[model samples]
Target: MRRLTKFSSAVVGLTVLAAAGTAVAAADQGDDWPYAHHSAASYTLAAVGDIACEPDDAENAATPASLKCGSPTLGGMSAEFATAKQATAMHPDAVALLGDEQYQVGKLTDFEKSFEQAWGGLKMLERPAPGNHEYYPYAKKGDNEAGQNGAGYFGYFNGHDQAGTPETQGQAGDDTADKQGWYSYNLGNWHVISLNAECKSDAFEHDCSTTDSGLLGQETRWLSHDLAANRRQCTIAYWHQATFSATTASTATVPASAPGAGGAEGAATDAWWKLLYQHHATLILNGHEHAYARLRPMNPAGQYDPAHGIPEFIVGSGGEALDTLAGSPGNYDNPNVVTAQAGAFGVMKLTLRSHSYSWDYKPALPGPGFDSTALKYSDSGSGTCN
Candidate 1:
């Protein structure tokens, strides 16, 4: 009998006890590493999205002023923050972001506000992917339409958090970073990939509109190589925007009604779906839909095609603006889905195991106190492509 010890710090409300099996990040590094084998073995991966936080100044200006500090409109941002603080206080391994890290449009100021508000407490185990709002156009020299949009995002994250490693952080522009905003690392037994959605159009032949090029190009090639290179039993990849979502049809939903919703889907459309399917990704986490929605093991077409169905979790409820919840769970066609509260603000917690994974969605609530009901919906399923 042997005892395993964890190497990475516990993040937010995650717990990683290496009392058994392999190293979690070994999926990328290898079995000989001194860590838990799979995240299933050491810890669980938890996520939240569309966590629209209100800057302290904005709090005073919210519509329904009573719930301003923590309200459905703000995706209960303040509440989720406290909940994450509590969860991490419970001693968890790591916390992840699904995207849409902020609201309105992404700018340096917006990111500063986001960090000050939503990202205030969980800096310990913070990892993220970019959502559409994070890509507000910034005019770069040569690339006008494709000017350096996510400058604010780049400035804030700079790829990975290097506070622990001086070598990785002190270098100029993340030259030490694996790639621009895409990289892989091993933790526990999981091989995790964080990609930038803004780069989805980097190599698209057509305008971003008519291409399935979200995580394509060099990123896709790298992802394929990364997956093939690793032999770990579990792999997880997350991005800010999803290639497939039934949340709102362009014509019917409020987003469509919003001023700039027309080119929204074109942002990261279907580019990553095929690659994910091809790589047999075990779990795909994403945000941007403002509500929480979990797709059954699915394929490129958004169908319940289970043969290689990768369980996709849309945990975009991270204290942001709540989109209209869809009327029903499986209805991807309805246009007027104001009742679709699945878009409430919150986060998802995943307990990964060697052979199975379980996920729970915790939504935001008014809080001078926390609610156990926040942990209302929970689901567990066996590994599919493993």
Candidate 2:
């Protein structure tokens, strides 16, 4: 496993260690020197979302088939476990859990039985954001069901006490009525923000307007403050749903007016995209679409802008069943989508540098019905900071 060199303040006076571990005199160091004491010149991050299937999913009980626990047919490995192994193989400095980490209402018992069995090992290194499944019950069918309201998400990521004190829930974000899981932190030289996109869920009473006088408004205000106070040259923000999408489960082609086209649920994030764009955020990672898509850099309006646009990547192909692409197999309907795939379960590996970043989507396992060759699907590229 590769390791990041830890340089002490004493060494800063004489020589600064570059990302490549070459010793350079402090006098020759550039202005981009990392200010954080523990900052690394470069680091790796493995990211994915829409992970473990519900432990009680009917597929688990099917003859010669199991989707929750490992199956003997697949060498005693579940899809989630296979992707977890793929992520662990990278030895990333941190894992950005995009969200929808546990399916079917995200109950605590389900997380422990399914998600934990595979992803628990990376819990300490995981930076999480909540998804609809974490907040709503029965996938938002009526909102009257017994929902965890992020209790399972917070309880698992923050600790066991579902109704614990603020400190216990700090890691996952405050799940109170006012603050709905939005926080920012510095990683290496980049500012990483995790925002909860379930603003319209039952937890928030379906009020996601900027003037919503509730969690939505509070979250937006906090995000604005966070962005204003950030000083990092490179920034990235993540949540569950995306402002741009390449697929919707019900239809092969998403209508322009649908929520999948940044309408309903995705529209709730318009303010967020605007703020990040204004702040020159470098990337936006999302995972509610149940497929993988690499969109070209674009403004908050969804217009392609190579110069000052924030690119978005939908990496929902973590472990759950894959969704269809926007159009025919080879042709994607969304013009902004540069590339997309639906049959491969994978993790996006990000190599973050002081002033730039690179991404490599590594397929771990094939989804149902896909042959072994599906594992060969790949998407990789490098980009400089905005």
Candidate 3:
């Protein structure tokens, strides 16, 4: 494989704003590119989301007093380091960070002091999506109605990392990014999309498919055109929220409070999934559940299909904290949910080929709870392009 060259993605020779898959300002052109895939036809990718434990400082608006970094084993600072360490070791062609890269209130100080310390190492190689936390205001507890907004998030990636200048970040994908929080790039033979899932109306968050319009329909429309113009045989769409979830018997006990994974996010809206499925997207990755789940191939209507459906993965366990299983395994009789596990902090690496892809999940050193539990999660397999 050779280094990817980014011509105008919009029109054949146009600079920006093309259908979608073709308008990249710059492709990843990975650090290890050409060398990493020197003699291979595929590229490796490290993908995860809900990353970075709060710094317990100003970045964490709610915990203004807990400035000291907490234990390196659990909810404090363990997951962030572990996941980043694993992703770096793999030397992937690109890292797709689903969302929630920072915690609590996603302040600029948080990204620099906490997230930048870990995952920032892979920022250049990352194709990121904006999470609900990016649009959410800082909340002392319940809903975040007044907070830092996404200034820190946008700036850090755009080279303007500082407080008060939160909006400085501008576009969400990366530098040379667009302000709409969405963009596309090429990786080897695959076309990848980094989308912004936080749709808003009157300064409040809404579902991606909300009929309220406002800032909701932009990405959906862009994605539809992008898919229609994609020339690649395989494609992947990633964002902060999951379009489908794995449910277990004890799931009811698990809080349904995560708005990003629920009504305010993509899974509940189904608009993104509908578009991707219609275009024959190969995979959908998300990180809002704080766990690792891989479901069977399925269509937009929630039915199984061996050949033409999209396979979804909920890999929110990039650190921050671990969430328990959705419920007892028995509660979910749906055969669609192939593998699901909670309390494991790790990263998922994908080997992207011209016409297929394979995934390997490696868990980090045991997090908070080390013993008395059997590790049952094992996700690794390859699937063909749609």
TM-scores for all candidates?
A: 0.66, 0.82, 0.80
Off by over 4 Å in 1: 1-40, 54-72, 86-90, 137-148, 159-179, 199-216, 249-269, 329-343, 366-385
lDDT of 2 by residue, 208-282 (tens): 786567778888888999889888788889998887778855333445223346445577787888899899899
A best-first ranking of the candidates according to their lDDT comes to 2, 3, 1
Flag regions of model 3 displaced more than 4 Å: 1-40, 58-74, 138-145, 161-171, 174-179, 200-213, 247-261, 330-335, 372-376
Index of the highest-lDDT prediction: 2
Model 3 C-alpha lDDT per residue in residues 1-386, reported as the tens digit of each score? 11211111010111222223223343333554323333247777789987776676543444543322584444456668878889988877677888888876576777778889987767656667767666576555343434544555776665562334534333354322223567777776788888777664223344345344544565577778888988988888888766666633223332222222344554434777788888888888887777787776777766776667777888888877666665545454345666666757789888888877788875774556754252435567777785
In the range 85-159, model 1's lDDT, one tens digit per residue, is 544543345567766665444444555665545564655455666666565442332212222244545556543
| Model 1 residue 34 lDDT score | 21
Between prediction 2 and prediction 3, the one with superior TM-score is: 2
lDDT (C-alpha, whole model) for all candidates: 0.50, 0.72, 0.64
Model 3 score (lDDT): 0.64
Model 3: weakest 10-residue lDDT segment is: 2-11
Best by TM-score: 2
Give the runs in model 2 whose Cα sits over 4 Å from its true position. 1-39, 57-77, 139-145, 162-168, 250-263, 328-330
* Model 2 poorest ten-residue lDDT run: 1-10
TM-score between candidate 1 and the true structure: 0.66
1 versus 3: better lDDT goes to? 3
